[model samples]
Target chain A: MSEESDETLLKRLAAGEERAARFLLARYLPRVLALAQRMLGSRSEAEDVAQEVFLRIWKQAARWQPGGARFSTWVHRVTSNLCIDRLRVRKSAPLEDAALIADPAPGAESRVAEAEQSARVAAALQSLPERQRLALILVHYQELGNRETAEIMDCTVEAVEALLTRARKGLKDLLLKDAAFDAPVKAVSGERQ
Target chain B: MSAAGLDEQRLSELLAAYGADAARWPEEEAGALAGHPDLKSKIAKERALDEMLNAFKVEAPDAALSARILAARPGREMRHGTGVWRALMSALWPEGPVWVPMGTCAAALLFGLYIGASGALTAMSSDPQTETALLSLAMADSVLEENWDE
Candidate 1:
């Protein structure tokens, strides 16, 4: 049914329904891919991680317990865990995977300033400890609630708040290092008006 | 309960800790700073940080990725088994490289053989008394050997 819920679709998927699988892929793939790309900073690795995640979903669909957790939350937790594991591996074997950071900037050099800014931010983001980066990505980018993020990170809501504070401060310090604090938010707000 | 709100100091702390997004600020303190002109300047600073954070974006995945992943789904049928077999299969045959199953199978076979062979060897070499009453027989034999020397 067009109105079918994720839990219903999962039940159908467990029954080996191809259409159910397609529905899920269409529904969640982009979000998962974005999450992976943001976390890993590499398109190829992100795709690999996304594919692995779905494959796991397919295998585990049959045993999925619906009410225990929302399917989206479960999917996010899996994606985060996979990304973290890959990051840890890359940390230990830096030489082998160190070349993945050369993410191609979209559009041409006409937007050189914007491209440089994005690159600087991405680099600073990548420089954060995995947990801190994860905290920012989950709350700021992914827009997950503190409760959901705490569940994903296996920490308390207070801990998530603390993480957010630390991550925001860390990013601000890094951005400030480049002398990019040209003006405060008020100036930007005035300009926006 | 007189609709009290956060003062400048508390407002700045909230902004610094939660960024400029009032939506993310603690609900109780969120409206506390509302309509307060004094904190507007501080709120703007927080929004600046949020904008800086928003500058980074992830590129959309290529369309082909969905197709590729869908195509690679495990074949249609999922087999069920006895509880022990299911646990064993899931652990040893987790979905991964084709080689993992082979490696685990080989390891499990080797382990099984080692245990089986060692058990058979023990059974073969064990004296009847040792097999039937190992602790008592060993202790009695040790005492007998010591008494013989006496």
Candidate 2:
């Protein structure tokens, strides 16, 4: 079957199509898992957040309307809010443990180098104020524009831009200071150049 | 590349755009690279940094991880209907269903009518004196006994 749009699948599910439910779950589940994993860091917690996000999707899908907001955008808002709430419970789950950011998948030899970079990014992110970190993440990885990012962050566009300015500088300082960042991207580049 | 410093605002703008998609470049901003020798070098440096950040995509959690996470879904982790309202009235309410105060109001009205009727009936069934008093009170046309003639 051609992949159903989120709106269509939601409408079908509302109309009592069980198959639509499964299809909906299968499609967005992976990415939501990744997002949760990024926020929670543990495979276990990410899994938990993933399930919660979908089950919410299951309950709410029927009420979803097209053109209200993009499904991807909605998911980011929902999942990101949940993550932030989870962070605030002071759950003793350190953002530090789950703190590492991920880059594109790299070859085996460069994996160690990438891990180090992830670690630095995580630390830098931790050093930022919560709002700033949230603002940065929404824009950086979530790919939300300033307007949407501001909405999610509950701030103005000017505030988001200001936060982004500081956040970029922070990331710059973090990366430049990391010893691992001095290493080359490809396996061969470090030794050759 | 020259030793000129990057203007902080413009440089941050480029980085923000680059973070979303490394290939994206704002026209006039990147176009400024040609005219300003200083900006030309900073542009190259910024592009390099953007590329470096893009190099590490976190491995998407494996399929098994997805399954595991999906299974472990948080929020109401307990078996369904553990909440106060859910525990008290889960079977009562369903999604999108509108509940009127219908049932409660019916029970209440029934109770009120029963009390009023029972009280009236008790007055009817009472001893003769009470019945006479009620009868006199309810009687709109009854004539009073002639005490003035005496």
CA lDDT, candidate 2, residue A57: 80
Indicate the residue-level lDDT of A100 in model 2: 36
lDDT of 1 by residue, A76-101 (tens): 99999999999878867653232236
Tens digits of lDDT, candidate 2, A1-193: 4387888888876765545655766777766765655554445666667767777786777688788877877777788778777767745744444343333334588577766666555555555555666666666665566777767667787778777656655556556544333323321111100
lDDT of 1 by residue, B1-150 (tens): 222645666666667667778677656665666677877656665677788777766666666887788767775323324477655664664432335567888999999999999999987898986675666565675764566698
TM per candidate comes to: 0.68, 0.57
Question: Which residue pairs collide in model 2, if any?
Answer: A47-B69, A102-B58, A103-B56, A103-B57, A103-B58, A104-B56, A104-B57
Q: Report the lDDT tens digits of candidate 2 across residue range B67-91.
A: 4434433332232345675444424
* Model 1 residue A4 lDDT score: 85
Kindly give the stretch of ten consecutive residues in candidate 2 chain A with the minimal lDDT sum.
Answer: A184-193
